[model samples]
Target: MPKTTPTPGVVITRSTLHKAQELAALSYGSVWTGPSGEESSGEAVARHLEATAALLATNGWDRIWTPPTPAQLAEADAAATTETMLRQLLDYIREEERSASGRLTAGDALNRVARTADGDPDTGRIAGDVLDLVVVALTGHPSARFGYWSERLNRTFADITALLTAGALFARTYGPAPERAA
Candidate 1:
């Protein structure tokens, strides 16, 4: 038998995409330099993946891509290995940041997101601005560079999980379909 597709309204919305894109931008950065005077690309990639994963977590498949059955939701959780990996990377970032710079203020860390594209109605523009700041911070320093990168990744991950959870709950409370028969 041919497979049947779910209804159109059952998936994630454009606003969700905008939000993910914003979060992703905030997460990209340069790699940290170890004591040996070398940088690790793996760290950078980890941060990127973590940010992407967070986006996924927040705007889960059902909310951002399509409406999934219970089985599909379970599969999504299984596929989210990125979340675990990102968490590890974040720990590394935090350690480095603490060692290199003592401690960074919240305003210093999230300033990028707050200052970009004032008065612009486009959400994407704001997101892009936030991303640029992350990129600058990651590449700018030698000591705590990796830490900044890792923290952004962790933040992204948190954003994703929160969004996904919120989307799921929203659907349960307000989705169009009647509750499925047990």
Candidate 2:
């Protein structure tokens, strides 16, 4: 008989399985920390199992298990797979908005002008030209006002993309750094 190949999108690979196990172990340790660690094992394991089941279901493996009722498996199947890219994009936008609002609040006249202008006075004529390009790209219009706002949004989006790219590069270069205290 020919060697059987794994069906596409059916079974989780060994590496994925190992990563899941590592995540589960980390989650278990975090949950079971503190003075009552002994008391939290059962609850932690239950949570871990639920998470594992949801992960499996999302990856289309819920049908492989025999004991769980169809209804239970169906509920797991409905669990959402993570959308990290969308989440990261939204987070970057929020951060940009916060930074913009902060600059505006500080009464920085130069920043205010730079933020709204068609072109930067200090940064050469490229700022205005870039804004014009963005406006045309965004609205398909030749109007100055549309171009101005479109430029603002485009600049903001570009800044955000750059920040996220830099952040990822830094994270990759440094590995996972210790989290800062709140």
Candidate 3:
């Protein structure tokens, strides 16, 4: 294959490492606190994930992504309005926290889905946006970052667990399907 020339007026994206360096600068510069005093770096990433999710939500990310299911991974092809789907997710979070036992906490559900969300990017990104909402929506509950991980992996896995938990939350809403009768 021959090297291709760039199109005029179009910009190429920076390398992932470069992009990460930029975000890392922003991530560390940020400061957030709760009743417990300063948040952990991972906790700060949780807040950043929440803000990033909110920005994506406002820009119509949800409308473009389908809910996860037994049949498919999430795709940027949802038919529902972003607001409608986000509302349902919010309502579902409320329902789960209000009464659903052993199944509502992102901090824990993240454990399994996190267990599984290892190699897929799309599934992970959608799940990140979704879990940020869930953990934050649940309120008073510790985020997976703060609740489940230690300092060494805090910031890195905070991002990972957020995505995994979001995927888990959406899966809870839409899939894994009913068990077949034995």
- Native-vs-model 1 lDDT? 0.33
Writing each residue's lDDT as its tens digit, candidate 1 over 50-159 gives 34334343433221122222211123345558987677667766665554522222223222222333211122222223333333332332223222433342344333
lDDT score of residue 66 within candidate 2? 30
lDDT against the true structure, per candidate, is 0.33, 0.29, 0.34
Badly placed stretches (over 4 Å) of model 3 are: 1-118, 140-169, 175-182
Q: What is the lDDT of residue 48 in candidate 3?
A: 35
lDDT per residue for candidate 3 within 110-144, as digits (tens), equals: 23333342312233333443343333332222233
Badly placed stretches (over 4 Å) of model 1 are 1-55, 61-121, 141-182
- Model 2, 1-182: lDDT tens digits are 32233222222233433333343344334322233322222222222223322333343221111332222112223345557555655676666555432211111221233333221232112222222323233233344322234223223423322222322232222222223200
Q: What is the lDDT of residue 70 in candidate 1?
A: 26
* Two-way TM-score contest, 2 vs 3, winner: 3
Task: Using lDDT as the measure, name the better of candidate 2 and candidate 3.
Answer: 3
Which is the leading candidate under TM-score?
A: 3
> Residue 110 of model 3: what lDDT?
25
What is the clash tally of candidate 2?
2
Task: Give the TM-score of each candidate.
Answer: 0.17, 0.19, 0.20
